[model samples]
Target: MATKLGKQTYQPDNPPFIISTGTVAGPFEGQGPLKDYFDHVYTDTLAGERSFENAEKEMMANACFTCLQKVNVTPQEVDFYLAGDLLNQIISAGFCALELNIPFLGIYGACSTSAEGLALAAMLVDGGFAKLVLASTSSHNSSAERQYRYPTEYGVHRKPTAQWTVTGAGAALVAGYGAGPRITTFTVGKVVDQGIKDPMNLGAAMAPAAAATMVQHFADTGRGPEYYDLIVTGDLGKFGRELAVITCASKGGFDLSKNYNDCGLMIYDTEKQDVHAGASGCASSALVVYGYLYRKMLAGELKKILLVATGALHSVTSFQQGASIPAIAHAVSIEME
Candidate 1:
């Protein structure tokens, strides 16, 4: 049985939930200035023939399958599947489900899908509707750019603050009951509108959302940044990270300048001109959390972590309309026993 730690009431019939396992990356590699940013790289001849969409599908499927194997759960044991991707129709998630042959609940949260999926999965378990749940998110640079912006061959100049879409995937298994890390709290975010209307400069567009959600998370939980070992933001790049620090300082009366880190900044050594200021995209936050930070937790290097997944909720159509870019963020706090 899962015990409720906080003052909030848990329904008597709520199912116990735990993230039993997870996996990341895939069997396809791309060489660019930012090649070294990824933790796992797949280099093989067969990967060359597949389109970006197909590669993304395979990556997501591999991640979910590996996660299931780690938790000793079969496809049939999963009661609900919630997933998302950066593609137009969430093609990767849809195709991955087809291969796994599991019932699915697709989601669209731009880059915040990982937390979004986790929150939803936790809810189902908490509602006693599921015993086993799987949630995941994936993104590929080539596919995302072609579908959302421009083609890779176009060679358009990007702003210095623009984030590099991560070519990776991350998945996790949330079970009804377990001794692993649990979802302690999910800070639901309000859409923060800073009225920035620049498609090329996503950092500016997303900074306010990150700040708003970070502040809200601290307030909702009645905890400060010192309560956690690490404070991580999803895909906010270097510029956005700075902005977030400043904004958070103003609102929370805490200087997060030294303690704050961005997944985008951690993914690559931008100083090497490999990827300018690291990685972005939906997979950026997921991979960093599941691959890098999760390992640290397992090693007892980190006990608590606050993860804020940020997203720019603007489409090409919305950009053309000169609509102010609205952004949303979701925060999830994880602690290792």
Candidate 2:
């Protein structure tokens, strides 16, 4: 007996879809002068300073505004908004929506909000439920730390695997069928629980989720890693990236050590930033993909790409209860024609 399976292609029957498959940025970048301030404080050179949260919110708002402008779409034009942030109660998303005065749907995926938001928005477009949708995610180190773990004045040391929460935001608009890169593929992830207890070790905790989702994505799409120019994971950082490689190698019988890269590691050069490794948070990977790589693809630097955003599915309440941290990852494939 013989069996046959169908292959999925990028052809859309209705119309050519061009989603806000990309993003824009604001002026202020990550960390800012905090590193310099820390260095000066260590040497007793300076005394008081302003709060990083205020600065981060300002930067985030600017980023959101700039992204809205770049897409040439007004708030009224957007049918729905999907947004998330690292801050408690999603202040950034809330504030952004309040300022824009559009219908909103706030989400929480820890650091993986980018992929989740895009996935949901893509579904809406694909289902013909809405014509245009905007999705966004953001994170600020100061805000996240204060809300989840520690205070900025504590100056606590972090584990090497820990990623610095990115102080940025990224927004993209997904449109109905048009002429551009469409959300060609989506691999919904499953939550994988690993018995790692350390909150500081997010990379280790989330690595398994990234690995599981990547493997499932390849299996579902019936495609190999070679099909993509780049396979980018969200904020898995250095440790998680290595673990993901090991997981994929074990399952797929391929070495992804060289081809696999993590956005957490790429956002800020650790040596220059003195951030130990790199960045994390919801916006960490989102900004890099939307602001950097998307532009490169548009410029013909890349053809096909697979973006996997990983998140640690642990909250303050869950962590306190000694519940194991579960991680989730979502993947989307984009191609330029």
Candidate 3:
């Protein structure tokens, strides 16, 4: 019954099972290295929708419905839908909720929304508050660019340190009774700001938070680096992942060079894709975890996974107002056994 573990950590008495998962990607992602992991890939980013926001909503809906189909559950059967996206007011999640016609809880964790929703949904199911819950998140590169930086018509060149926002959506189904990987322990991270104000340089801003959360998870769960078969971070890209490893080592006096991978780096091939740093967005981690790694867990190739999802919690208004980017990361432990 005791769910709390250390500061900001939660060790659920009964870990909810990850019953099913779904992933959908755009044309660019379809051509990427992990293209086969996606359940559906759109030939166009708009998916025939007039607006990018509508496309995003459709993408999210496709993912959620795909997940439901996999488990033979209807939207009405899902007790709660906890979802979010990078758009202003989380319009994608909101519209998707309306279409799905299910009880919804809209969240905002930037790129970390996927793991954040998973952790919250698992808590609800494990606590007996709900028999089944849906945790979903999405992002579209075009939508994000138009909202955060410039309109697609402007065609601004991306910086070398900048990361391409992934155009994809992922959905995870958590239930009290299911046959799949279980959510074990989670470490909720605190907001970390190193006074880095450049929006393009998110790697430098978010690395500290990823490191802080990873170190806290180790201390709280008493699980060293070797305990997890893989340590995965969400949307940190290549540079951020490198700095996170170094930062964790310096803070916790342990090296994280082994069995560590970033979803951003794993989503795309840096050389092939024009993604400068790597991929970053809610779906970056979503597609990798739900699309790629979940299958690995089910195949017995992986047993234990420490998934740390990082988000740059900065807004367009905040950036224009000269506010520094504050990053946050949430860590969740997943076990196949």
Candidate 4:
């Protein structure tokens, strides 16, 4: 039986292992600092497709196929496919599902979709409902921009706190029998709003939510920041990163200065890339988790890791209505046994 810890945490007695992962990045991401970590990098952001949406679909499908190939599993063998993205109605995930022809469950957690998918898949497998499940997500700089903000063709000047949406796709295979990093537990977050309304400043919009979830995770697990080898945030850019540290310190007495890091800050070189603050979107945390962290865990470098994927749940309609951005973050605890 799964144990519910505190308010929002779940600890499964038999945890599901992340057997394999596949990641693909766009041209911009290919040029980023973590370029070497990606498995595939598209020279053309459109990826030979007619539209950016099509390109995103192709990237996600390719990532799913690549994940399956790593473990030599076919789509037919996967019991369920769990995925989501930033597009409206999750079109990217839907198109990818159409190609894979697997049992699909489309989810939406804004930028936190990756972790939400993984958490749900882990629960499905741990609950003995499925033997294998695939969790995947994607986000294109072009696609997300048009959906949430002005199209890139507008060439709108970005604010200093703006975070670049990641142009990439990342997928992972989760199963019960595997010798890999196991997802031991998870904590789901609620929508949190701190009255931040600027769409460009996603980091600030999401920092409070990240801090809330991190504090809840510690409280639920009865562990301090030192319990994990590293505590990673999904994409709380630069300003958000600093704010999260401050919020955690004041809110929970947790000074995460020693072991905390942000995927947004780690993924790109802000100084050269001119990405204002850093990176965001679904792939922000996905690429880092699937490409960099997974390999490091296999090499025995990281024994225990906490991945907290944050999201800004804002839409053009909501932003236009003068509503504050509501954010959420989901945390997955990974451990190598």
Candidate lDDT (C-alpha), each: 0.76, 0.71, 0.92, 0.94
Query: How far is 34's C-alpha from truth in model 3 (Å)?
Result: 0.8
Ranking by lDDT: 4, 3, 1, 2
Error of 4 at 287 (Å): 0.5
TM-score for each candidate, following the candidate numbering? 0.89, 0.86, 0.98, 0.99
Clashing pairs in 1: 16-176, 33-274
Clashing pairs in 3: none
Q: Which candidate leads the pack in lDDT?
A: 4
Error of 1 at 250 (Å): 1.5
lDDT of 4 at 12: 86
User: For residues 83-115, what per-residue lDDT tens digits would candidate 2 score against the true structure?
Assistant: 888776877788777777778999988888998
lDDT of 4 at 190: 91
lDDT of 2: 0.71
As for lDDT, the candidate ahead, 2 or 4, is: 4
Q: The CA-based lDDT of model 1 is what?
A: 0.76
lDDT of 4 by residue, 1-337 (tens): 5889999999988999999999999999998888898889999999999999999999999999999998899999999999999999999999999999999999999999888988999899989999999999999999988888886789677889988999999999999897899999999999999999998898999999999999999999999999999999999999999999999999999889999999999889888998999999999999999988998899999999999999989899999999999999999999997
Runs of candidate 1 with Cα error greater than 4 angstroms are 1-18, 26-40, 44-49
Candidate 1 total steric clashes:
2
When summed lDDT is taken over every stretch of 10 residues in candidate 1, the lowest stretch is 5-14
